[model samples]
Target: MKNEPVRSEAVGISEEILRKWEAKGVSRRDFIKFCTTMTATLALPLTFAPKIAAALEDKRLPVIWVEYQSCSGDSEAFLRANQPTAAEIILDIISLEYAEVVMAAAGHQAEKSKWDAMEKYKGKYLLIVEGSIPTGEGGVYCTVGGESAVESAKKLIKNAAATITVGTCASYGGLPAAAPNPTTAVGVRDLVPGATIVNLPGCPVNADNLTATLVHFLTFGKLPAVDAIGRPKFAYGKRIHDNCERRAHFDAGQYAESFDDAGHRQGHCLYKLGCKGPEAFHNCPTIRYNEGLSWPVMAGHGCIGCASPGFWDTMSPFYRRLPQVPGFGVEATADKIGLGLVGATAAAFAVHGVASAFRKGDAMESDKVKVEE
Candidate 1:
């Protein structure tokens, strides 16, 4: 268990010059405003806001965010974060010197940028890992500049003040990590021993969580408090179902039976259809998606539970509640069971009818009783 970092070094931020001004660069007032926002995001003391401003002025911390085994969805998601126009946010916050996606440079030039950032900001920058690392074939599954992503991340994370693992693909093995896990993908924690890792688990983790974590780190010079699994409690503390709007319908035992069923029209709970909100942790319901517009459940789809550990495997039966759905064979189907049962019942009825006819003949022929009787 490594200890938390104390505030920025005393002489570091408040050096000889109080303010630095460049006509083309960010203004002092703009600096203070960003700092204040950082303070509010972290819920820190007002007094510390100035410290944040001073630190940015004193030193521009480099941030290197790595990608692996991902569709670059994490990058797409961060680009789509609800606030801050994504572009301005990245450009304004920490000196994002090496992201291949957004950096102006390309090919060999892009590679050089990363090397420069690593050299200049060693032991000071932040490292954010966005996907899983392949441990197979010496980590050859994914590479940048001919070096394995694992190797690249290892070099970057070693000197970083802290590392943030965002999205389920980075936090756990994710979909690419399903069963065969061809490349044996692993998370940052597995590769970077003893480094402080803050895991934010989700398909595309709530962007606000990422921003909030960054703000907390900047304001306090330490990773925010984390839960046992290295996830920040603020976002991952509660079960989605606990705060979901459909929870009331769940408690009332109203459920959507099928795609266009009556219950569905009424917007009932989707647990019967394999919603994993009760088992997964996230702020999806609270924060929603598309800048607080709506989430899966709110959009009428059951939560696929992309945030929970091994969700692609464990909480499956994608539309059923049963944990281990019976798999008779690959060719099995519900219609098969219904037809099989119906056939057996019909056979049994036929046999019973024959037996009754042979044994008694209704007991009327032998007695020759009156027609009415």
Candidate 2:
């Protein structure tokens, strides 16, 4: 018998992308798996995987990534993505026209590249801002190519189709806008009012979420739905507590009181140790960082609500408990609430059992009467 040649499963995927993936040792299965993962991350149906693949095959998205006042932690996180390596993302997904840290072009040449992209793809390219804009000192605090951060942001925002702010610094002013706010730093939204902006607010924004957000735009030709705070609902829809691994501990009132306690070692809930999971809305527990290896909570540390607005000040005193849980009162302890829920559930079941027995008895009595008749 003759052997059959292996058929390619590249389907709608472009040869260019396949070649790049092949060069990077990414298989067709791996590419599909990545697309599926992205589909789930976007909260889209699994059937959307093909659509996502098709979208990736379309024209490479023109993206202009700009940074101002930041530690570049978000950029670092973004570059560290391993599932779909940074090279794949940069080369296959987006035509990254301008980025200061990674681009080979420097000084005047770099500035020219950014300006050229903005002009060439006006109202077409996506703008990703990575730091806060300094409004103080006439915006002299942060400048790029002799242009003030404010001026640069205004121009970029004006010409781009939409702006995506990565990290808390770019979304809500972060540490730069913290107490005493020396630079009078503000986010891009503050600098360019009334512009369409998607805020991915985290100390170091999760790269997976950023990739998914871009995929959603490419697949649907529009940004994903956002919450009241301009954050994608798929990424920030539920509180971290809702899906935390220690949620069972929280519900059972098994809490770690101190860092050195036995409960801490046993993986008890860190609610008492200033975990803001109950009040913080993010997908950290589910999506996780470092390619889903683990998150802060999984590593025995509590979430500091780094994704929340004004987290620098509000989530401070990071080693203390929240004033109160959202629905429960300030005085109500987890134990009390947990007990109440258990008791209520037990009571409901007991009542249902008794009612069912009575109904059975009544039916028996009615049968007896019919027999006598």
lDDT of 1 at 63: 90
Can you tell me which runs of candidate 1 are displaced by over 4 Å?
Answer: 1-60, 322-373
TM-score for all predictions?
0.73, 0.83
Q: Candidate 1, residue 294: CA error in Å?
A: 1.0
Give the alpha carbon lDDT tens digit for every residue of 257-291 in model 1: 78689988898988667676655667788767776
Best by TM-score: 2
Query: Which portions of model 2 show Cα errors greater than 4 Å?
Result: 1-25, 328-373
Candidate 2 lDDT, tens digit per residue, 174-222?
8899888999999888887789999999989999999999888888988
- Supply every candidate's count of residue pairs whose N, Cα or C atoms clash at under 3 angstroms: 0, 1
Question: Which run of 10 residues does model 1 get worst, by summed lDDT?
Answer: 322-331
Evaluate residue 337 in candidate 2 and report its C-alpha lDDT on the 0 to 100 scale: 40
Per-candidate Cα RMSD to the true structure, in Å, reads 15.7, 12.5
